[model samples]
Target: MNFVKRAGMSLGARKPRTAALLAIFVVLCTLLLGGFLLQSAAARQEADAQRTVGVDVTVRKKGLTPALADRIGAADPVHRYSPEVPVRAEARGFTPLVADVPAPEGDGAGQREQGPLAVTGVRDLGMLLPFSYGSTKTTEGRGITPEDAGRNVAVIEQRLAAGNHLGVGDTVHARSADGRREVALKIVGIFQDPRRDQPGWAPPHELPGNTLYVPVRTAQTLGTGPAKVTEAVYKVGSPDRAGQLHAAAERILGGGGFDFRVNDKAYRDQVRPVQRVGAFAGLIVWVITLAGALVLGLIVTLQIRERRAELGVLLSLGEKKWKLIGQHAVEVAAVALPAVALAALAGSLAGQHAGDALLGRQGDEPVTAAGAPDTVTAPPAVRVEPAAVGKVAGIGLGISLVSTVVPGLGILRLHPRSLLTDSE
Candidate 1:
């Protein structure tokens, strides 16, 4: 009889044993496919997190102008950009917040010198650390955005707005100390600052309640000299891209007094855990494969010993020893195909739940937008794919061959006489 036909007959004759072996094969294949799926999912999530969470690059110099900031912000690697320019301005209409501490009894003596309110210009106020970190919140209307770049708009602290009886759409006036440059700003938002007047006597511009956020252009208009920014912040998709942004800045601003600081805390917080999950999944795959091979190999060896009478009968009929081994390999490999199919189905159904159990729930950090409302994106999810199935099938075949062929070697060394005598 053909070896393949004989192998099929043997499996049909031993239905109970075949069913038990088939059950074992399915469990091994399921775990192998699950591991592959997990590793693939973790890699995909890490890449997505890097792009969404991103890294912040801060460039600071003595006289960083708006023009230079714009040039750096225009880099391809930069996802979002903001330039900060701070200026002191005296309130024209309302009584601004003054320091509670007693004024120095000297040149600028006890004469109750009301200081100017703090005016900070930015391309996007939402991207400010205070607002993004939740230290300051927009309690009314909206905050200054990139669209307000050329417009005369402002977002004031709640206390300052309350003191002046200002609401959204109200106009406020401020002037330079010299009274030479004046700016009329329309209030678009009101933010709450959890700060009080300090004990030390300082200018109003340095006071927390007197702080106001406005478009970078509006603040620049109040200045006399060339328009300059205190510092510029650019956000890139990944920490590795910080070098690209730095190179772009070097090309435009040159390597001088400017320094670049990269903040990758968000990236580290988010991506590192996913990387560890992937590594653990890879380890699981190797360990499972080896264990499955050893277990199946031992089972095949014992089955061969019990089938000595059958093997002796086949050898007495002049069947080739290699064909005897080939029959056993064919039986094991036949069981592997259905096992892989069942594994693929199980993975497609339960992969996501397994991934979540392993990775746990990861919270997405909120991202403050330039001109749009605050948004948070959902994290990437685990999924089963054809590639993972194919890998499991390939590994299953290798396991079957190793389990059957190595033990089958013992049969090849015995002659037909010794085989029949041993059976007797």
Candidate 2:
């Protein structure tokens, strides 16, 4: 009989063994393929989310100016760049509720409870905070525009505006906390802070409600130099580029008396957990795949022993050893084919649940070493795509081939007379 006929008769004669082997492959393939696909999808989603948040790094120097900001903005990796001039301003018309905390050294030799409102200026108002996109979304009239440069316009926090009974189009007079210099600013916008109260000790100037954002030129008037900036903030699409960004800044700004602080807190808080889920899924894939291979190998080994007489006859009839091996490989593959096909659907459903369980644990808030609470990143949405299906199918076929070929290789060494006598 031909190879195809031999393989079919072999499977038909051993229905129980064929069914048992097929069921085992179906279950193991379902787990291995599904777990692998889910892990891959989760990893992609996590990377996209991290890139959306963008890595943050601040450049500070005693004599740094907008020159550094300009050079960094021109860099290809930088998505956004802002030159910040942080100054203290005393509120004239109203006083927003300040958190009661012991202050540092002041004009009066004694420690003070409240400090002046923190007035921070930026070249681009859109790139305000480091948390993520829309962290400081405006809810009121409008944000500070490029045309508003040198126009003395400000965007105040919603809580500060409500506390001070201020609204859009109202002008507020603010005097420099240390000097006699003062400026009047028209309220242009009010933004709401999406960040929750984080646990940790924070300086008054770092408080969201205590900040007032203004244009670069307006804040420059409050400083000594025309381009004086206390902080130069830059955004990168990924954390791995932090060093690259720092190098670019140093190369362009000519590093001296400067400090570079890179913060990937958003990536750490959000993407790290999702990656962990993917890693766990990947580990399971390897374990299940290895176990499945061993189980299938044993089954093929036993089948080879039982079929030794049949192989001895085929070899004695002038059939090549490789053709005999191919016949066995084909028989096992035929049994595994349908099982692997059914596994595709089962794997998808099972993979989704496993992925969700892993990600759910990551959703819990992280405890900080410094007793400060931080925001937890939300899990990214995952979907098994057609590509994943194709990939899983490929992996299933590979598993089937490996399981049969390795154990069936011994068929080449079967002695015709010895196998025939042993079978009797």
Candidate 3:
């Protein structure tokens, strides 16, 4: 019989077995493809999140000084820089007074007295550490603009405003450490520090408390001499170049009188957790896929053994063993081709759903430790693209062909005459 006819006859005669094997192939292929897609999506998402947050380096100094901050900015390695000088001050003309209210003859009632408030001198609160309080803009009323640096203007927290009943354009008196010098400041704005929620050493404020913003220059003038800056903040050229820029800053400020610190170090430190999770997931998927392939190969081998009798008859009829082997091979190919195609399709859909679950469908929901959100959107359709489908199909086909071909070699040694006589 011609090869084509022989293969067709063999396939037609064992419809049930062929169908069962084809179903097995489909299930195995689907599992492998799904696992691969899930791993790829997870790794890509994690890498993207890490790059977005960038890295941070901190430089600390013995004392606040603008000289060192300027030197770091002028250095080649530093990409961007901002400076801060924090100082304490006391509110003047805001003394606590107790009052006595009219009461019955036997009743004595006196209001408790309040104490003077301590505050900090902030240069440009929003520039170095930009943050907002509820709905208030950090620089709303009048931030520390260059023009305001030398003037007696200030920005205080909302809690301070409420406690003192202070509003924009309200004049308040603040004094230096020795109470030797007092300056009048106009309330230009109100803001909250980002670190207000954190514990440990924090400025004396909770979102709306005693913290205040004044031009760094003005604060220096009010307290110490020479309007110096203790800390610096910079806007980087690009995240990719952050490392190089940081190195440059360190080199420039290494022995300078001040220390440089990056404000975003905490955010950068969070990337480790996301990376660990992604690596663990990838390892698990690979293990499961290899196990499935082994189980599938064993099942295919067993099915071939069960059909040995039929194969022997064909061999006794003067059928070229190679041709008979080809027949069985063709039957497997016919089933496996369509099975893989269907599996690939199913895998693409499964991957899309799994990706959504792992990464989230919302663009604004945080996906990484740095608080960066997953911005990946689902494609309009869940079907695998043609390119990806072709690659996966090629791999599946290769695996199936190998599984079918390797065992066919045993058929070549069977003697049809000996098998027939034994049957009688």
Name the best candidate (by lDDT): 1
TM-score of each: 0.81, 0.73, 0.56
What local lDDT score does residue 235 receive in model 3, on the 0 to 100 scale?
39
lDDT of 3 at 132: 13
Q: Write the per-residue lDDT of candidate 2 for residues 1-424, one digit (tens) a residue.
A: 7887888988898899888878887887677666766687677667665555557788887878776677887887787667777766667777744444444455222212233577777766665553234445677767665567669988888888998889999998776655566789999888787654335534545667878888877776665335568787777877777788878877887846478888888768767777776888888888887887788778778878877888788878888887877787788678666876677767556655666666664544432111112345455445656676666556666766787788877776677888788899
Error of 3 at 254 (Å): 4.0
Residue-wise lDDT of candidate 3 within 52-150, one digit each (tens)? 343433455655466666666566544434466665566676532112233334322211111123344443343443431122345336556545656
Work out candidate 1's RMSD over C-alphas: 3.9
Question: 2 or 3, which is superior by TM-score?
Answer: 2
lDDT of 3 at 197: 32
CA-lDDT, candidates in order: 0.83, 0.70, 0.56
How far off is residue 343 in model 3, in Å?
Answer: 3.2
lDDT of 1 by residue, 200-289 (tens): 887566678888888888887765556678888887878779999988998999766588999888778877888898999999999999
Which ten-residue region of model 3 has the weakest summed lDDT? Answer: 107-116
> Of the candidates numbered 1 and 3, which has the greater lDDT value?
1
